[model samples]
Target: MNGPGKIYNTINKCRICGADSIVDLINYGEQPLANSLKKHRDDVEQKIPLTLSFCKQSNHVQLKETVNKELLFSDYIWVTGTAASTKRFAKEFAQRVIQITNLQSHELVIEVASNDGTFLVPFKELGFSNVLGVDPAENLKTAALQNGIETITAFWNKNVSEEIIKKRGRAKVVMARNVLPHVSQIFDVVEGIRCALQDDGVAIIEFHNAGTILNELHYDSVYHEHLYYFSINSICYLFEKYSLYPFHADPSPISGGGYVLYLSATRKNKSKSLLQFMEQEESNKVNSHESWNRFAERCVEHKRLSREIIDKYYGRRVIGFGASARSSTYLNYCEFNSGNIEAVIDNNPMKQGQFTPGSSIPIISMEGGLRRKPDIIFILAWNFRHEIINLCRSKGYRGDFIVSFPFEPKVIQS
Candidate 1:
């Protein structure tokens, strides 16, 4: 949503740790919605101002604007259950929580920003008497409820947190996977968690690790919706400020090129293992301005290499597969307009009739690939490359698949 000379401003200091240290890492300029690729009868387009900024003081990467909450969450289209990897991850997470915490049947396990009950279903099946999912996306919450998962369709702020605490008491285990960075007010979210969590409660928050994002040159993950890219160094500082401490952490490959952190609230002192991990992260200089510059250079290199390959293969029609949010970063950063990618293909029917947010790439059904027969299919959602390749092959679409991320541009034949 552009206007006449509208300027997006952000604090010079880190939002999480309140440090004056700051750095400019990646700038994707103005981009459209990554997953909002639907076609309306009116044929009008909606665009949002997008940019990525890094906290030099704490190494937390985030967006520069405070987008409308409604625009960010109310009618979210992305469903967590759509991806097999996510479903499997959720199942594993639930099982581990049950084992580690020795959670009884009467105990509660609540998940914030739980989309479509993907992560809550397993916990419910395990006979947890109280399983609650708090999400701002009304549409997704409705879907979760319909799927037999009990959920509250509201934003997880201090007010909602107080209500939950008053009614159901504090939660034993609160899981917020891939949600923290989307929030603009970091303090508010943490405070909400503090208010609702039991004295011994553990709040595991998994987000795209800032260290891995910079190291792997995942500039595409930088979008307006994702306000922050967290690192252990930054997150620990925030935890200390809010009385929530980092007791344990296990890095996992969940997002495309990102890592997840598991945190909790307790009076117990920081474990030696946790201290060592923090030391290692500091020694590696994951939050330095120099490291951010290197990441920016890599972003530029990726754009150049990807554009050159696509231009060379201009004779063949290019189509994008996977309507993922990360795909927006890839398309916008690389400047893939209508001329480069003919359309996008997604397995989810909800996205089939929609167009991509910023790029305006018309989203088509998986069958569109077989019918249209594009010569080069770009796997924009590169994380699921293997599964996508198999899907395409099964659908009888034989073509070179292009993967753009973590590594350079390459075309694989299947």
Candidate 2:
């Protein structure tokens, strides 16, 4: 069974704009902690309550409760700069900052939630006198230090922001990439940025756009860790609240499905470009509740078709690729059990020997894919489908691949 009843709530006021005008959007029923992987001997596990709600006033999607931060951030398994494309993005972003700001060699650049210092190293190589990374993950911070990147293992809250301001002064440029959505109290995170930034400094925050997620039917992105799903309209409202401004937005296909955002705090005078984009999005009905409801329906249909397709052909030899956090929702919501999926194969050695949190499906190495030689491989980590397909090909596994999102299951010949 896919859990019990759905968790519902009523929001009279918007979290972003604080307006009394609010309406219900599509709700993704109760879900467990997506990233909570199980260890061999560790039996203790916490199943936090989770639900998704949308604010009609500002079009901001948010989780109903404030889940524990430790479960998401501390001892985090996922690193920001691990993927090849993300590393390229980090390096390119650093170069662009230097070019746009005309930063002097002595100017300082800081990044919050700078996992493993992947982005900072590029700035360091550019001969920037000061470059600092602040992240709460102690292990990752130590790893960054080992890689010759200066890092402070502390959460970037108001207190930490004040300390940094006093010791290092305001940073010339601050970057928080893919970190905003994980925050429970978004206002506090924005305040921290304001404190750490110089008067003329600009802060760039990148997040997964809510419009893309809904329109593309990216239900996998819905996890307990991600507290907010931001659209340009919602983000604009959020920025205004914190005395910050969103001057620009450049949609890109960077993070798997799509990412459409580039916000700056320096421009007090709002750009017509941003307004035009917002208006265009509104015209397209991107913020309407009806759109999300329809999209949610599509997601359900896709899940049904995928289950049917897999059941028709494979019988019992199907296995999943990518034991990712998103796979948790897919498995739990679709009522998939260990019987349907023989095992999960992952490239990360840390997770290879462990089991999935909710489903308890054993995670094995990529070698297992070859050993089992299943007829079809259900790609649970659909975001990295291209990379995974290439990897399986390199490993000499010629099985068909399955994608269970956007539309019901479809097989891609490799």
Candidate 3:
């Protein structure tokens, strides 16, 4: 389907195995780019196809459609430091990386998709004197540099990795956190990781666990930016193809609960926990088409329940709690119209004046949203539901706060 801006094409072959066994999992229809918030009412909204598919051969679940990299990533707005989950994860991940790899002061460490150098800040403070970040977003690069983090304003690839190799030798640790899903060149990114590391170095990659998504029914996590979902099996399959062996992985509390895969060039004994996790996926029918079909059905029911609650409070003064990318997917999928939501409250100043992508609900400050004592508050960032509700109650708001999907639709009194 052609959209208002650039048209994207759907792929027939699997991105990992190069097999023409891709099967349709679900489609979210034409959606405006998740982070494309607008400054004006008449701004041109760029809608594109958002789809999910799975490979029958490799059991890899990915998007059939591909958006232009520049259109999606250039001048990016989502920063890693914005969310508490990400901030906490960065510090913990830095320490975990040190312990896992035995990283030293002189040994170099590199991070791809290192937005605002949130992760690199700790790497610098934790004795890794040589730390570098590779990202394409100019705004984030500027912020990273201001924080005394050395960053290259480029996407990670074999060429860029070779350049890093030439400039500052092979790195001991290459940390890629929650980046594989956004990466367009699957093979190239893996090859770049392989090329960027020393023979003994370990490349740690983190991915949102497919098991969590399937079990928790996090359909909001699916959007244009995320091109693929990863399971333990899929991670192993892709790495082994490039002679990189996956030796260790843990379901870490990074990016709202994800699996961290530790890969090296040489073979090592797979941890018992990693093997057990893979077996759990098999038992859960992670690769079966029926699981995906049931997931789609569940998602539809979730949306229906949301609309039922939202439709009840028709003319009430309702404001969305978080103006996040996930909120964009939720609003768009549930068809939450502007008349129902007065404004979206956000702590991020960058989003305050802009309007949400598809919904066009104006983004306002916390003060502005709370000033009128809204009758209904819709919590869009469900992951931070506890924090949001507590904040509302602390601010003297006793009205009911609504948490977004998967959970049964009910307004909680603050």
The true-versus-predicted C-alpha distance at residue 246 of model 3, in Å, is 1.7
Model 1 residue 190 distance off true place after TM-score fit, in angstroms = 0.6
Candidate with best lDDT: 3
Candidate 1: stretches off by over 4 Å: 1-9, 19-21, 38-48, 257-260, 267-280
Worst 10 residues of 2 by lDDT: 1-10
Q: What is the TM-score of each candidate against the true structure?
A: 0.92, 0.89, 0.95
Comparing 1 and 3 on TM-score, the stronger one: 3
Where is model 3 poorest over a 10-residue stretch in terms of lDDT? 1-10
Q: Write candidate 2's Cα lDDT for 1-414 as tens digits.
A: 122232322334666777776554445555667777888624566555556666665666776555657657788777665556667777787787787556778877888998889888888888985989999998888879976788898878778889988988888888888788888667888888878877777777777777677766777777777777777777767766767777655555454543434445556555566567677778867787777768667877867876787677656578798877777877877777677888888877768778887777888988876698788888888777777788888878887888876545688876
lDDT, residue 6, candidate 2: 27
Order of the predicted models by lDDT, top scorer first: 3, 1, 2
Clashes of 1: 14
Poorest lDDT segment (10 consecutive residues) of candidate 1: 1-10
lDDT for each residue of candidate 1 in 1-414, tens digit (9 for 90 to 100): 224343334556667767776666666776665555657523555555665677655567667655656666788888888878878877788887787566778877888898999888988777775889999888897899887888998888888889988888888888888888888776888888877888777877787777777777777787767877777877777767878777666656677644444566656666576677678778878877787777778788888999998897776788989888888878877778667888889888888877776677888888875688898899988878888888888888877888887767788876
How much lDDT does candidate 2 score? 0.74
The regions of model 2 sitting more than 4 angstroms off are: 1-13, 19-27, 41-44, 257-280, 313-316
Task: List the pairs of residues colliding in candidate 3.
Answer: none
